[model samples]
Target: METVTRRRTVFDLFVIDADDTLWESALYFERAEEDFILLTRSLGFDSPSVRRLVHSRDIERLALTGYGARPYLGTLRAVLDELCPRRPSWADSAFAEISRALLEHPVILLPGARQSLEWLRERDLPMIVYTMGEQDHQLSKFSRSGLSDLVEECVVVERKTPEALADLLSSKGVEPSRSLVIGNSPRSDVNPALKVGASAILCSRERLWQAEKEDILDPGRVHHLETLSDLPSLLSFLEAAPDSASRDL
Candidate 1:
């Protein structure tokens, strides 16, 4: 069966999120996992045993703490402690190295991100970012990322919700109906955008956690896309939006 894709045409502003949405951030955790594996191997543990322990620990941490830098650091510490109690010296050094690396590492922007932002800049379309995190960490990333100058404004909110987005939009003179929110998480980005009458674009990432699948499948108001390059076409789609005429008129 052929499916009809809905077209958007009224959007005037683009509000994007950083972290996993714009760049390659989560791979730090993956590298930490490799460190865990090496530690387990040194302790004479097999791959299966190491995998089971790490997976179990990760699940526990997520359930208790959700996702954040501190929780991730704690999780890594726990894994190291479990695998190398006798070699506490090694664990200390490895953990320190991983933590330092994560703190300094900037996320590698996805392909076409820079070019797409440049295109939007050339068009004079107001671009902004809405993100949730510690002020220093988030702000520092933006300053170091080189994408900071491209955006007209940046909002670091305490939380990500419909009310929060609406508040930000109202303060900035951006109408929800004319704003487009682009990000990687459907739960955090799409649902909230829809609730506030803002449109959304969901850019699929390479490593979306399994728990996030439901949101992606049932995103309330979003255009699912494979890459950032699709953004130009999406903007065109919005520019060519269908006219709505009322029967009374």
Candidate 2:
């Protein structure tokens, strides 16, 4: 809804998500998709067919194996094979350009992310960053964003599941209720935290490829926000509420 900009003096720990929530990660992948389209077109392939084939292959691979760089790169290769049959003569150059573009893509931090982290840090709240993806890519984004130093810990988790979140909180001796998870995905971020008895702030940003909406844990226990700018007031409101205080205890 609407959030009044106010400072929150409570909250022991804040766990934030990287990728689309914190930075412009999806944009890079989107650019890669565009480059893929051009590459396929130049190779005498139909764009829609190539996309459909790759999408199907990716879904199948993700279901059977898992989602990661290997499977993703494999999906691209599969699409290339389907389009040009055993890698065309121009494949090498096209692939290199696409890869370079993806690599050189900048990580654009969302408005209010750094400010919010700094504010919480100033208030002595322990803020941690957690994301799921290839470790190298995720960490590289963090380094580019320059917010890595603001976080006490930067965790690149394999899977963003409820059990994983619970384990992390338990291992750190942080009660679930005392922890807050802020992220963009309902499936990966919000529901998992809510399932683990932690309050979640779901920043409602339009993601380019949300291939995991099929499974979302308890969707009710989430506070939806238009942007992270609303976070401060939401935290303040929650802290002022007696119910939230009891849950934290």
Candidate 3:
């Protein structure tokens, strides 16, 4: 008797997330948060209280304002206004500067971001940059990222849910089983993708948006790679043992 190898199904469509996955978006926001803390502390507000309030308001405002640089800036400003009714001139100026910094920040690729993307391009995989944010901002980041020439398109959305993922996959005529969703957040990337029967690859990062973290229901179809560069090897392994990918770890 001879052992048989279950050939892995080739993932034709690869939809990758922007932000913390490819470039350093969250880092700037984190820095801005620290700046906000410093500014509020200078205005007599407790640093810890300012951070807590900013985080709280940012999350709550998402449903109403959607995700974007402006919304985040607004949340921090709102916190400042509520705590200090008579905001100083410098406070407003500082907030405006912070907003400009976030909006004008360069798209700095991560350590293995470009190399990994290049590898995928060489392999000729159908890859798309799918992210949730203000359309103009997200597209602008893509243009500056140096990856615009590599990927077919950069998609912007207000939210990434199972339904949204399903629609994207369907629009491309790619079945869930033959598609891959890679991102840092489980809320916006992994869980919703898995729910739609699509395999997800998490570009794991230490510090991520609090809301993006969610429970993974189907770990079998999920693959965790430390960096984007690790993807080629993982895909190779899956090619050899496709059916066993879920239990490989």
lDDT of each: 0.71, 0.76, 0.84
RMSD of each: 6.1, 5.0, 2.8
Q: For candidate 3, lDDT tens digit of each residue in 1-249?
A: 556555434677889999999998988888888888888888888888778888889889989988878788888878877899797799889888888988888788987888878888897878999999899989999999989888879988888988988888899898887788889998899898888877788888998888777888777667888998888787777666645463333
RMSD to the native, candidate 3? 2.8
TM-score of 3: 0.91
Q: Residue 102's C-alpha lDDT in candidate 2? A: 76
Give stretches of model 2 more than 4 Å off.
Answer: 1-9, 63-65, 68-70, 214-217, 243-249
Q: For every model shown, what is its TM-score relative to the native structure?
A: 0.78, 0.87, 0.91
> Candidate 3's error at 20, in angstroms?
0.9
Stretches of model 3 off by over 4 angstroms after superposition: 1-9, 242-249
Q: Candidate 1 — what's its lDDT?
A: 0.71
Best by lDDT: 3
Using TM-score, give the best candidate's number: 3
lDDT tens digits by residue: candidate 1, 145-242: 78977885677875577898999889889888878888887767777887787777888787764444444433434678888887877666656644
Candidate 2, residue 249: CA error in Å?
A: 15
